[model samples]
Target: MDRAFRWAFIGTGTLAKKVAREITASERHVIATAYSRNREKLCAYCEPYNAYPAISIEDAIDRSDVDAVYINVTNESHYEVCRQALELGKHVLLEKPFTMNASDTEKLQNLAKSRGLYLAEAMWTWFADVPLQVRAFVQSGKLGRIREVYMSYCAYSIGYAPRVSDPLLGGGALLDIGIYPITYAYRLFGFPLSITCNGDIKNGIDYGEHIVLGYDGFDVKMDVSIVDTKGEAMIIEGENGFLANPGYHYGESAVAKTKSGVDIFKGQRSYLKEFDSVADEIRQGKTESSFIPPQATLDCMRILDECRRQMNLVYPFE
Candidate 1:
């Protein structure tokens, strides 16, 4: 309602801290307060932004000064936390992998729609400039009728960290890291008609997975691993030429090559771009983002659900 949105964060973890820093640094938004179970840790994280730390989640959500709530909790707790925020009539910007499955995502979407509240999944990559440029190029027919997409995101966690190996915390490559490549493909090509998955599992959780997603005219082959390292790149092939990003997943640039030669496209971090979208949605009093709609989030969840089912990976919460 005001020129700047008053924001509160639900988790004071590393990601939350980073976002808090961004929000505080920006003039368009202000950090009103932050909520975390660990008061000491929350205070420490909020100190840089001079944000007051709420003693509990309820206090944070119910604060009259707070205009929106950012849900940055663990994977298993995202749904519940977001539900509470929505119930409190606070707009929410949820972290990626919105939920463990489509059913929960649908429930949240429906709830937000019913409450006339704005709810968004923080898929920051979708708001990036390079992706937008790539999409524009594709739409312009430069890359004729996209033929294939290949992506790989992996890191060796042989030492078996709790977050990477634990089943109780919704640990796995698919939910944790694989969702990036999956979402990237979905953003470019939409949900595939069919998907096949092969995974390495330990203690009933997926450590690594190779997923092949099939569409009518194109195919997406993606690999995500916790026990191995991948090149962390994305390749898009079309009938005419192709676009390749050596550091595709989190890079600042990409290269497009055809029969002629190579053309480089440079970009900067676009995470803050999504904040403008969020601000516009709030200003318009819209319940959903036009750029990253609820249906897209639901589709992503469905794909992840199917991938996990095929891999026989199950989290304790599920």
Candidate 2:
């Protein structure tokens, strides 16, 4: 690891720009290439970063200068981009939700493992340091026997977002914003013994949903929506007390409540720390992140698929 890891960005959107800026500012990596559906927009977007505007997605993955690819493409295209990137013998940092369904995600995960290449989900919550602390609190044996978990992530997706309302594009509230709370529940409880979910469907897309995952002795209750939703509280309740985050998706801090006392930790949040972790792992010749494990991403998608099934939500792409 004598030099920086060059990243080829597959999507030239706001998130891509943000990631590039953070990587550059941190001095841990460099943006080597950029690709987008719109060639004109791609060239213009790469101008500020001085990265190569790739001729195609394949060109971006096949670039000799790039050590890895940062895929921020739409939900529908995530599986294809990830598959092509790994096939080209390159590492991949895929966007969240991994894919539209669990089957595609399992295939990609198997591909990455078979290739001995690094593949990870770019879920900012997993990368952020704050959630790690909350996880520690939950696992520290301080909360006693886990009783129940509660989570919710709901937002109103308004205008100009194709992937949120278009069925053909894999747009839905469950895939877009709901997956956060779903991931949190999975992180704490793993796969549930039984799951009962109810959600709204409009024109083959999911508008909102409520899910109850039954465990051995506890249950996980969660709700998400494209329109307004309930409170944003992610808590893991136990016999003795509880461990909570104000929100699961953008978890900014950790809160602990017990009979003796209460403790709260609101740590600093930034995107640099996670990208730095990826750079370090790549330099060490590692393929997957210890923080954002590949299986967790797969299991989260499974839960999402079940929810979609209960809601009878169908996407045109699937």
- Top TM-score model: 2
Clashing pairs in 1: none
Q: How far is candidate 1 from the true structure (C-alpha RMSD, Å)?
A: 2.1
The CA lDDT of each predicted structure is: 0.82, 0.83
**Over 4 Å off in model 2, which ranges?**
229-231
lDDT of 2 by residue, 15-57 (tens): 8878787778866688889899898999998898788998998
Q: How does each model score on TM-score? A: 0.93, 0.95
Candidate 2 vs. true structure, TM-score? 0.95
Model 2 score (lDDT)? 0.83
Write the residue-wise lDDT of candidate 1 on 1-318 in tens digits.
457877888988877766666755667787788888987898887787778888888888898888889888878888999999999989999998898899999999999999999999988877677776765666677777779888888888645546567777677889888888888777777888899999988877887889999988888999899878765888889888999876655635888886656777777675567776787788788888867789889998999999888887777766
